[model samples]
Target: MDEIRAKKENKEYDWYVLFVKVGYENKVISQLQSYFNKKMILPFLPKLEIFHKYSNGYIEMEYKILFPGYVFVESNLNEMKFISMIKEFIHYYDAPLKLLKYGDSYEFAMREHEKSMLQSFCNIDFCIEASTGLIKGNKTIVLKGPLKGRESIIKKIDRSRRKAVINIDIMGKCVPITVGLDIPIKLP
Candidate 1:
């Protein structure tokens, strides 16, 4: 708790918690990391960018981070107090609960990450390849679970949601589905 106004006009706080509007989480996280040593959790997102390889083995890269907003922050009481000094436009997600529950510790960081980290949006073909290396497990590039027959290409990866465009041979139409970074839908 920092006493910005001490003595006669003093105000005290136990901790701090805040939520950045969509697309602003990164801005705040970057600023905080550079300015202070406070611990923080910014749910990382993966963006699909086009990559090309030349015959000479020259490689090119281009992409964007998928998810936006929805960041969970954790830090020490003393360090977090500095958040008050921030003048950016942001709102508190769960101010008291976040402050009381999370702090400067590995457990706090891991817990926050587990709660908001990547979730599988949809399953692709067996050897499905992504521009990023976020995919996990023995599934390799192939998505695990029931969405096996689905061979779709990522049409758009938005901060709010991911759009996968799949061409249905039977229907002869493209279908788009929104999926997170988690395992695709379970087999029906």
Candidate 2:
């Protein structure tokens, strides 16, 4: 029981952000997982599920990176050891992998609140599904999905494109992430 509790607490707080070359996020994740066993480290790439429409009226579901070129990781190793391990393993990959640093210093681990906020938006697989909502007067009420109770974080809503932009502060930077939202009903 104690072991399980400790692990859950560790997962909630110990997330590090890595910046990989654009379009090589998956490659880096796979390489890291293979290099170190899955139990040693877990990499997460949050994706947004959206619908793509074709001229023939066929709609297809597609996944796009919620935060491109960035991958979040939870590892059991200490900070220095983890950094050393990643630095050594990075040479094997074709793409570049660097830990996100601030102002000439290495501050890789995310704050607990930041990780918690991200987890709330993403599911177990780190995917943010499309949110269904209704427009009531000037307000948007998310009836179902990850955005349901988090409407206050919405910075802008593009109804036609079915996307909502939310500003999330991660690694001490405010990033605007666009997620899928469908407001099918409008009530006066």
What is candidate 2's lDDT per residue for 1-188, written digit by digit as tens? 13323586545436788888888888888777788867667887888887666878676678999889998888777788887887787666667777775546777778777878888888777888989899999989999999999899999998767789998888888889888888878999
| Candidate 2: 10-residue stretch with minimal lDDT | 1-10
Best by lDDT: 2
Measured against the true structure, the TM-scores of the candidates, in listed sequence, are: 0.29, 0.87
Worst 10 residues of 1 by lDDT: 119-128
Q: What would the per-residue lDDT of candidate 1 be over residues 93-188, giving only the tens digit for each residue? A: 222112212334422222322322222331221112232222333222334332333333434333212223332211112334333322233232
Off by over 4 Å in 2: 1-13
Which candidate leads the pack in TM-score?
2
The residue pairs in collision within model 2 are: none
